[model samples]
Target: MRAFVLLCLLLPAFGQYEEMWGDKDYLWDTPGFTTTKPKHKACLYEKESCGCCLMKKQTHRMEAFFNLTHREMKKDLMLTKMYIDDMRASRSAFSFALDKNDSTECLGPFSDDAGIVFRHEFLNLGNNYNPMTGIFVAPRAGVYSFSYTISSDMKRAACAHLQVNGEIVSEIHGQDGQDSVDSDSVVKAIKLKAEDRVDVILPKGCIICSDKKFSNTFTGFLLYATV
Candidate 1:
């Protein structure tokens, strides 16, 4: 009877062990559990590699966009600079006229007859003409067109010479024998170097009359730059 009781107890313990580790594919089996750990590690490595590739692609795209933007900005800046330079290079013109009364005369009979000073300024580009000195100093080397007018009062005569660097390039003369006033004008084109001086001069024993109507005038403009 004791033997039969011992045999029953041992039989229950053996059945429990077999149930715990019967199939190799079960989660409770030790060999199968260790194989799952290697598969988990491989999956993690693949995910990390994919993340690194995506990051590199994003960095490359950003770099390309920045380079293209930089090139466009540089081109725009160069164009703007060129336009500014062109505007600065093209500046040369002046115009002036007699601004006093009809009785005013730029008279000259003295030994040193410099010129008549036209004190009025209609337009003086480059600020090269001086009303105070009666001289227009060339600001750049270029071909220039100059025009001048002279008016004479009743029973009077007037004459003037347009001088460039102390040499006469043109002249204007007017005389009034009748009761009406008389006027004369002249236009001329000349090439000039930078710093060349130009002015209108009344010769010895010559007279010019002007009124509030600015009939007597001087004008000049650069056609194009030579240098």
Candidate 2:
């Protein structure tokens, strides 16, 4: 498979090999030299054998092959470097939870829709997710995986909406009047382009519970890059 790929890449160049490198005899004497030419094996197969040829065509072919191989290797190296640089610039991922270093509490039963800011960060390698506004902006085009958990007061609705660019993609809801902890979760994989916004929305009259144990959480990662 590897050889096939290289052959595909070099076929065009190989077709013009003789034009790029002229057919010159390697064993020929200089024009000014009068020395007697040494005898070399005159085999039937000029190319397939190691026998020294009268014109030494194999020697010239070997030299031209080395030159072409070097050029192809250099071109491949440059392309690999370009791809690595692009990947470094485009990487993005983040994981965060609500209310780190704080006791049990309920956040937001706000009058208007609000973004949930997760204060506890487990991993924010790319720093794409903003803790202040609870928003993640994609760095490049790719499929992304996101998982969020909602824990809220038993008396208030435990709900949250996964919004991408102001449009809701998924939701988790727990109705009021529960005797135990009201918790819900949603996991989704979505395709996004560069600069797309993602966030969890806490609507009016909704709350999320959090504590030192981190009952509510939000996480996202770049699943795979795309064109």
Candidate 3:
């Protein structure tokens, strides 16, 4: 009975020490990582069970990294494409003189090497029925708008017609010995493909000046496009 009593007393003392040790050290060190909550950490235990905390943190970090990387990559690609397009449209303004009875025409394979003379594709503009003419062709595909004016200081009758693709598109005329410039007008904005054609057609009595070079002619019918 004495031995039994001594054994019970020793068991109580051991239990007390074990509880005290757990509270002081084992609770924090038993799992190889500190169990004490970080003061700055959110209540992760309230939102996620401890068993799942590590997996959730890893997944969230990976997703954030991927989103940042993808956005930067897209911005780089758009900038590169914009640079290439700007280089492709590098173009120069082109101009040429038109003659009173000369027909300027467009025939194939335009060159950007300068000194451009459009080849005549039709003979009707030079026909005797049409004494004055001018024409221009698009050097590249783009939006285009045109303005035209037919003028005369001489007292003679004239008629001017602007045509796109063989159709009469705009016209201005002075008849019965009138000396004046045609009212200025603009063509509807056109979206032309490369090599599209435009022409000016004038009847035999378009402009009249004593100087043979300026007599019964068309003047200042200009066509151009955004390069």
Query: Where in model 1 is the C-alpha error above 4 Å?
Result: 1-69, 72-76, 102-106, 109-112, 175-180
lDDT of each: 0.72, 0.78, 0.42
Which portions of model 2 show Cα errors greater than 4 Å?
Answer: 1-58
Q: Tens digit of lDDT per residue, candidate 2, span 1-227?
A: 45435544564545545565443443234355333433353232234332344223333445688888899999999999999998887778898998765667887889998999987889897899999999999988999999999886557779999999999999887978875778888899999998999999998889887877788899999989999
The pairs that clash in candidate 2 are 151-209
The lDDT of model 1 is 0.72
* TM-score ranking, high to low: 2, 1, 3
lDDT of 3 by residue, 117-219 (tens): 2122222221211223345555566665554444444444434566666676777666644434322333445666666666555544344222223232222
TM-score of each: 0.63, 0.74, 0.39
Q: After TM-score superposition, what is the CA distance of residue 152 in candidate 3 from its true location, in Å?
A: 1.2
The number of the candidate with the highest TM-score is: 2
Q: What is the lDDT of residue 50 in candidate 2?
A: 26
Q: RMSDs, each prediction?
A: 22.4, 8.4, 19.4
